[model samples]
Target: MSTPLSATFRAILMRDIRLAWSQGGTGTMALSFFMIAVTLFAFGVGPEPQVLARIAAGVIWVVALLACLLSLDRLYQADYEDGSLDDLALSPLGLTGVAAAKILAHWLATVVPLILIAPLLGMFMNLAPEGYGILLLSLLVGTPALSLIGSIGAALTVSVRRGGVLMALLVLPLYIPTLIFGVGAVDAAMGMVGSSANLALLGAVTLVALAIGPFASAAALRLALE
Candidate 1:
């Protein structure tokens, strides 16, 4: 009997999540980088509450963005290197389903931890009381876009050795709009402006990323395979 498509998709998703949690995995590295980078910013900018609070949203968003990048190179590389990508491409779910599964797995294993711990980081940076909820909200809404958009860059560079730098080069520019709205939402909540519009825009960006990421990544994977 053939496996169902949904079952295959779940299997792929679980497999990636398990892989990401293993020794020296992407999730561990990304989370560690996020904490260290944000902590370092607090130290470098001095302990002034006003100073840390002022830059906290931007610093957190920037570090989060970089942390997301840390795992992009490995996004498709392991499967490609091991030739399982070919089997996946031939599966009932096909490359698009594979890409989508990996994207969701990336978000769950990588960015979700970042979102959960962001409040603690927010306190560390002395983020204003009002900004904390919006900060978490922004990360929750905005980071799916990061994972989705990042999959494109990862797929594009999957066949290249040492493609982490190249993937970042390609993806970081694309990340700016999401970063802007994410920080803007938090900043607005801090009384710089109204946060509603920024949050809407951030959500919109995630929706757009959802619309395109899977197909774009799948196309890139197809080319890499060929």
Candidate 2:
């Protein structure tokens, strides 16, 4: 019998989280990398608070996007290496369901932490309090789309040698729209330019990704598996 949707989702999420935890440094490494990247920008641009505050939205979004990218290679590579991916393929749950759960797990593991850590990073960048809230909110809506779209790349390159570099190349172009709207929302909110339009665009992109990402990822996984 097929697994119930709720159970399958929960199981998949748990499995991914457990795996991530076992990796023993994924979160710490990604977080440290994010902090370092932000710090580099701070130093590189000089310590002008006005300039930092003005650029804070872009800095946070860019760092978070890069942080997420740092972890995407492991999204499916670990499972594929260990033979669990084969079992998942043979399981009763549809690949789309698996893909959705994996994307959710990726968001939980990567993006959620980025949101929680962002305010601290924002302080370093001299982000306004109001802009911090906008940054968090935009990331909440935007990063999942990153994970979803990234899953397709992960699946496509899972079996290839040197897949990580290829995955970055494939995924980065696709990430531009999300990055634009995400930072735009923050900028709009901070500038009193009205963030609703940017927020709406981000939501539309996310909704489209939610509907299509799973099927696309599943297809890629099937092709890789074959």
Candidate 3:
């Protein structure tokens, strides 16, 4: 029997995830890039623990953002090139579902490891014990917005050859709000007053991104396919 809608959605999600895993070192590459970026930040800033602690939240978020950019060009470009996107669009799940599934898969493949590793790296930057939980929570809340907004850039530029630069220019500005609230939440957890407010605002940004991303990406894909 053919799969149900929910099953189809799960299949799409898993398929991309599996492909991402099998593709030589994609997940590891993003993680390595993230770690290296943070390490370099440490080197450049010198070894003052207090300074590191004060900047840990921003540094992690900034490096995470740049690492995300590394993978965006390939998000839909491979499928677009290989005609898989065309096939996906023809599936009963439709293009919007396809976009949503792809974005989720990207998040799982690229951002999840960052979330897992951020705490350890934060410790290197002198993140307080109390800050670890909030760092993870903030990233959990914020990283989805990165993938969702990124997919819009990926979709919008799916047709342009070597469009990574253009996509970055278009998408990085949109990322500022997420980055701000992400750092804010970590700061709050470390004793900044009003952090709960930051967390709420971060979650709100993610919700808005999720609400609009799939539809925007799907529409852009249709335009490119035409």
Candidate 4:
């Protein structure tokens, strides 16, 4: 009897999640990078509360974006190298589904931890009290787009040697809108200018990424396999 497609998807998702949480995995590295980068920024800018408060949202958002980028290089590299990607492509879930699973797993394993920690970093940066909720909300809504949009770059460079830099070059330009609205949302909250519109726009960006990323990533994966 053939395995169910839903089961295959679940198995793939669970497998990736477990791999991500293993020692020396992307989750650990990304989280550590996020913490260290934020701490370094706080130190470099000195201890002026006003200065830290003024730059808090942008700094945290930029660091979170970089953290997401740090993990994208490995998104497809291991499977491609081990021949698991070919088997995945042949499965009932297909390449697009595979890409989707990886995207979700990446978001859950990597970005979620960053989102959880952002408030603590915000406190270190002297982020205003009002901005904390908006910070969490923005990251929750915005970071999925990072994973979704990043998967395309990951797929495009999966077969390249040391493609992490190339993937950054490809995706960094694409990340600006997300970074913009993300910071805008938090800034609006801090300024009391109403963050609802910014959050809505951020959600729109994620929606667009959701609509396009998996298909684009699957196409790239198919090309890489050929």
TM-score of each: 0.98, 0.96, 0.96, 0.98
lDDT string for model 2 (1-226, tens) is 6667789789998888666656564566677889899999999999999999999889989989888887888888878888888888876677888888888888887678878999999999999988977898999999888888888889999999889899999999999999999999999998899899999999998988898899999999888778
Best prediction by TM-score? 4
lDDT of 1 by residue, 45-160 (tens): 89999999999999999999999988777999999999999999999998999999999999999999999999999999998888988899999999999999999999999998
TM for candidate 1 is: 0.98
Q: Report lDDT (Cα) of residue 35, candidate 4.
A: 94
RMSD of each: 0.9, 1.3, 1.2, 0.7
| Residue pairs whose backbone atoms clash in candidate 2 | none
Q: Candidate 3, which segments miss by more than 4 Å at Cα?
A: 192-194
Query: After superposing candidate 2, which stretches have Cα over 4 Å from the reference?
Result: 1-3
Better of 1 and 2 by TM-score: 1
Q: Clashes in model 3: which pairs? A: none
Give the per-residue lDDT digits (tens) of candidate 4, residues 1-226. 8998888888988999899999879999999999999989878999999999999999999999999999988999999999989999999998999999989999998899999999999999999999899999999999999999999999999989989899999999999999999999999888879999999999999999999999999999999999
In model 2, what is the error at residue 70, expressed in angstroms? 1.4
